[model samples]
Target: MTRDITIVGAGWAGLAAAVKATQLGLKVHLFDAANAPGGRAKSVAHQGQLFDNGQHALIGAYSETLGLIQTMDLQPQALFERQAMKWQYPRGECYALPQDAYPLKALRSLLFSKRFSVREKSTLLKPLFFSVSQALWGKTDDTVAHLFQGVSPKIMRDIISPLCLSALNTPVSVASANIFMRVLKDAFANPPQSCEFLFPRLPLSDIFPLPCLNWLRERGARIQLNHRIDDLQDLDPHVPAILAVPPWQASLLTHDKYPQWSMLAKHIKHRAIASIYVKGLRAESDSKQAPSSSYPGSLMCLNDHDESEDCVHPQFGLQRDVNASTRNSHPEGAEHWALIVSAADPNARQTIIENALKAACEQLKLSDVQLELCTVEKRATFSCDAHLQRPPCWIDSGLMAAGDYVQGPYPGTLEGAVRSGFQAVTQLVDASFVSSHAGNTSRVL
Candidate 1:
């Protein structure tokens, strides 16, 4: 029997497509090489602890991603902070961007914050006064560095660069000026809290993928696991197959289908990330007067090295040294803090972890704590490079491709992945309607 749809790769993109398509009343078949779902966000159990292969945080601007999560009926509180992000600089000075709608609050915070130089603060506010002409015009034909020309190197190095790299997973220089602009637009457009930072509290498998997987099974969607299709020819002669695989892998399949896929395939680029996970018997949050789930400086740029101190700021999530001891198992003195660090460059994985651990200890003043466990994960993701080729939703008659790699305005993020899947399913539905109409006409003939 011809299934209504066959989606390749059970990653976030594929799984999202499966759920959405199935809900649309199409029979869905999802194929993946991984034993589980969530792809890069998958989780693994280390001893008694369940740790995600990497860390993922959701922003309030990510409405589509959050909508999907909400649709799955997962408890939002379990998966996200749903509050304003709290940032701590290396000097122990702290800032809370606040989770509220007042732009004035953000403006005030910038004014009083000691983190930025007078010049830096002015450069940051330049966005507010940017010519309404240029604002409407969006990104100029300049690099990110060009965008921040007069800003202090400190602001760029410590703040903007880290935020950009974490979101786009590319260095500021390499990231598209337009992409970075979108990030700014979202932050400023929403109520300050609308941009709340949300990371998965449970393992990623459970947070994002497992619920969808279970739903697919209950709905009788055919899910094939541990099967890697190295070649497109390996797929059955099924029309409407969605090739929701990665870029390098997609490149191989597109070589023969240039007439069909060359344009889309060329727009996709891969960036790599490494995640270092450390176990804490106590939650790092307990140590602070106000516990924080994420720290902005944890994921710093490759070049932002200050050797005077051994530890770097925890930019993305936790800030602590790799050598710091896990706290006790409760707030009294315990709760494990899992320090997860990520960077686009694969080579600097070790050094980043070392520096991160060092910084965590220095900032927390926990040099005397006992160590628990440290593990590193490389190949976190393929950089979603700008100007790469993207394949179409439908290809080779019965075959289609989906995933973040499919055509989209944004890079390969959770939103992009979901959008791609939604697009492929739409294409399939349209094509099916046309095919059915033609068949009925043939009978009349």
Candidate 2:
């Protein structure tokens, strides 16, 4: 039989699967309920200015994602501004990894960072080395907080906590240590440049999904936008289908035919990510001035004490300076910035945005600021806890699953999503090939 694949959802995972399937000589049909392609990572235009759903950051470790972008002929250099990894805190402490070279730069930075005392630096480095070495053997499947039992409280609050929330979208106290270690290993254990940061210059949609769609369309793949699949049974049984929607949506789509999978999907918990886009801020005249309370780093972590019952201390992104050129090209006049809050409370979204804006104004020395937009993704990512049980890629021979929430080494990230998509399509192709060969042999006999 001729190989064909039907993908439900036009998000990163679905797009990845479709692209891979098409490359493998399989006819592909991709569907999405949205008018556009990108799901959570898409862009929206407000008053002639573009803003993403959230501030999505990327690193060199996103190999699959980079490869997919390359496959689509989308230049990563054009889409993103690559820089050295810098973890700056609002309190004026910074731990920056060198952009020039890997392990050497990392070691040098750790040893020479002015932010930590000798003892504090040693305390931080020892655990990281231990964790990396332990990862080689086998990591403990415990919470991150539990894993770093003897680490200093200062390191936990300043470094580990922020990194955990940003990476896993889960608090260190509850996030899976094994997964966290894997992320760290991938990030730091590789070549020196692997630690470099890639900030999207364009909107998330423009960077991947839209370009991917165009590429797929050019390759004769049928893509249907604003198309919702209400019933999985409606799809052709001869052609394998990949469900790349969120867990809840997947549960709804597969509840009848795949009851067990539906149950597993339903059991998966999720976390929220909130981004507050503020306008009417003035750009800093002097870029070289020392970091101040009213002028924090362009990207800085908030202290725990700054958090409230309804709001977590967000990682602020001052796009005012960075987007100055873009703003000049566009009709929008005001300076814009984004504050990303992970695991945000939906009920207190307004309060969270308000608090974040207030904090930004006070810290960044902004005299006048107006809220442009506030986007909250309530089910942004699965709760990456130690005990979380994600659904597998191969749901059945005819039906497969692909999404960030599916079983993977890393947490629910863009890399995880893309990797899952490729994995699902590969599994489908392999199964089909095997089945075809077996049937041909039986017929000959």
Candidate 3:
């Protein structure tokens, strides 16, 4: 029980905690019900080819995630396709700041950028610069919808809505303004080059999970895949545990053992992320590698994002490897696309999938396409509403929770999940949760 930690659930969060605990020279036992890692963001194999269950991307601001990959000795650049964060539509309206550009030069690029009109550009910068005032005066502590008071419809249609949906997974009307502002500040003003997007070069699994399992095994950390933990009491009471499962599942495990904590975890609401996989994409319609570099076609915002309806889902379904090489992995090769619907209701899966696919086809000019699969991450992310209060990490003395749902500045993103897991283990070590079993606890950094 001494210096030994049990990590339940091997999603990004659980895996992160286990990694940190092992790095601090502790015994790590990681378990997940799923046969493979990557939790909700894992790659699913069907008909012999791999497809991501949910779409995932990274920003340079995700230092913890990037560091975790590096800790495994895997090159981040090798796993992902990096580009400056830009919101480009099929019809050509877009907005982005170059990765190498920063400060005044960046502002100039944005100011004169043809993405939006002169007035619309002001609408865009208002909230960004407004972050300065918010920091100086304290948090606005309101809904993101409030930020659009003077914004024109074009700006809302071409800009704000998509960013809000892609970032928060919640509509602008309810997404936390404080959190949204924090994301904007971190991506832009807080540091340099963080605005770049990191799209996985292959299936999401190959990006981190499988490699992490290998790294953990090599270090003598025990991993139990397809091993489910239904009851908390079944765990060695003396051994510390990190529950990184979804809030609902955690609620079930801790219902009687920790009623109050269970309530907190149970009360958290969730929104679904439905990933619609489409095949038979023609190269002319495939934007992943457009003839022109200016296309920025890897990820594009689709139409039908009704601002009044409060949805800003990104319509990304382009193939990552649109070459002959991928044909061996997937029958369609260059034609696989994973279109996503953020904040979709899982109960209405069929309706949502049908409408989303229709919108994507018409908007992206996709033709002769066939629906390969539809993955609905039932609890993709907790609803990031303005009124939300995320649960704390420490649930009890030797027990704690780790997930993006826990209290964090960022939204329910992979970075937030990674940071939470890493910090949970750090807290365990600092609090001497593993000290009685071992003497040298200074290894934790």
What's the TM-score of every candidate structure? 0.81, 0.90, 0.89
- Show model 2 residue runs off by greater than 4 Å: 99-104, 283-298, 304-310, 318-334, 433-445
Encode model 2's per-residue lDDT on 1-445: one tens digit a residue. Answer: 5466789998899999988887776778999999999887788776677777777888888989999999987889877777667766645657887656436676687678787678776766656776767768875588888888777777677777777888898888788988887887788767554677777877788899998998999989998899899898778877779999989999998898789989999999988888887765445662234233232114566654433222454655545333621344632444456778877786778677777788667654454777778888888899899978889988876789999999999798999999999998777766662122222221110
Question: Who is ahead in lDDT, 1 or 3?
Answer: 3
Q: Which stretches of candidate 3 lie over 4 Å from their true place?
A: 104-109, 124-129, 190-192, 281-297, 307-314, 322-334, 436-445
Local accuracy by lDDT, each model: 0.60, 0.76, 0.76
Shift in Å, residue 395, candidate 3 = 0.9
The TM-score that candidate 1 achieves is 0.81
**Compared to the true structure, candidate 2 yields what TM-score?**
0.90
Better of 1 and 3 by TM-score: 3
